[model samples]
Target: MSDVNATSVRAIATKDFRDAVRSWTFWGLSLLFFLLVGLAAFAIGYFGNADTSTADFLGTVSQVTRLVVPLIALLLGWKSIAGERESGSIKVLLSLPHSRIDVVLGKYLGRATVLSLSLLIGFVIGAVVVAVMLSPPAIADYAGFIAMTILYGIAYLGIAIALSSITKSTTIAGAAMFGVFVLFYVVWNLLNFALQILMNQGYFSGVEVTQTMNGNEMQYERLPDWGLFVQTIDPGVAYANALSVIDAVEAPGFGTAFSAELFPSGVPFYLQNWFSFLILLVWIVVPTAIAIARFDRVDL
Candidate 1:
């Protein structure tokens, strides 16, 4: 295949975005997203008694970013190529002098951009509203949260786009992709839990435990922080990772523990943050690459 032009990608992206922003499907759902996030920020700000801490904000923000943001991306992406195929537009679009890979990647990127921009705007507004109402988090921390959330959303978009390539029905594509995303969120936890039980029961008997004196008291805990090591394998761990990133310095007053013990063990607090980001990245890239490869072999 010939090189994909920057101009073509941008043109396709712009077209996709315009169509997306104008459609009732996009606006209707996006409006709901804004309202939900707005209400969440409101609840946390007003009724939450400004009892917010960095961890509280981070946790809430992560929930919004990781879950809600991904759902929106899926909504945009699930229908992308599938809807085009169903409407008989894919042939015409594919006939245009562009590689299928470019078309697919450009569309996905465009929709991901829309999701990222919408979420970013909501985050800014929410941050301002919270700041005005209560003591806000540090600017740097909130910024970091936004960056991580955006990356997390991009990963979900990959999943949706890949799923879209699998079917020609928008509804089926949406449902299937949503189901998979839900599975990603839930499965890792089940694995983590099972592994935790087995580990604590000495399934990995080679795993060592050590006794340490924190302050003259002898405490026995598993070495290599096997329990925490288990958590690293879970998606919820990424949510906690994002939370820890935001709450490292100034946590909120929500009675949520910011202690290192509350975090997964075996890694320094900062390393855990990096590790979680990497996990989230893997979560996005692996399936996405598979989808792209699958699409290459299928006749679209």
Candidate 2:
């Protein structure tokens, strides 16, 4: 691979970003996010009782975005490189003063920027509506949610872009994207159940813990720390955990009997909320790094 030239990378990124903005996909994402936030705001105003706060509203929105943003990112990036190769456009890009590594980096940054901007626009519009309807929202919490949401989208975008790079056929890339969606949303959730099965069959040992409820002692077998760590590594789970830290909003099970018993001596470093941020960073970095290495060696 040719030496990476910062100038070439920037030039390609700028061109790609501008080209993407001109496409309908960019505007569509903005509108979708806007509508999503608008609906959240409407629900909060019409249905929420006196117990609700700005954190509650943002948390509810985060839950929706956690599922939707990945789909948008996958659709946006599924064809970024593979489509170009199939259409003979990749040659034109390569013929310029750019290396394969440069193309990969530039495409990732450009698409990441597009996704981030679309998210920001939607969040801003939603914030405006939310501020007017709700008592002045918590600016810091809202900002953190937006920032985290962008990071979440970028992680998925990296996965999508990497999958796009390894294939010459859009069909394969499309399938890869679908596979990723299922891997995270479906398979990740089943991991805990699978772990339980293993424990039940004596493959993995469960930790014995005791709990007292209503002056009655109960004994139960919980998954080991390593097992719980594995569950939290999922990007969506990490995102939710990270939000609980930043937003100061107790998530559904925060300080609950189950959670307290799960970490009797305090949460492990790997299972803590801060670690989720690192997990997210890894999701963004590792996939792109692998793709860069592979794409550089491939006969594109």
Each prediction's number of clashing residue pairs: 3, 0
lDDT of each: 0.66, 0.85
Error of model 2, residue 44, in angstroms: 0.6
Task: At residue 6, give the lDDT of candidate 1.
Answer: 79
User: Candidate 1 — which residues are off by over 4 angstroms?
Assistant: 25-30, 48-55, 135-137, 200-203, 210-230, 233-236, 246-271
- Kindly list the per-residue Cα lDDT of model 2 for residues 82-148, writing each as its tens digit: 9998998999999988899999999988989999999999989888878766766788888888998
Writing each residue's lDDT as its tens digit, candidate 1 over 195-270 gives 6677678766423334334655343434244555556644445655655655533333211232444333644543
Worst 10 residues of 2 by lDDT: 249-258
lDDT for position 237 in model 2? 83
TM-score between model 1 and native: 0.78
Each candidate's TM vs. the true structure? 0.78, 0.94
RMSD in order of candidates = 4.4, 1.9
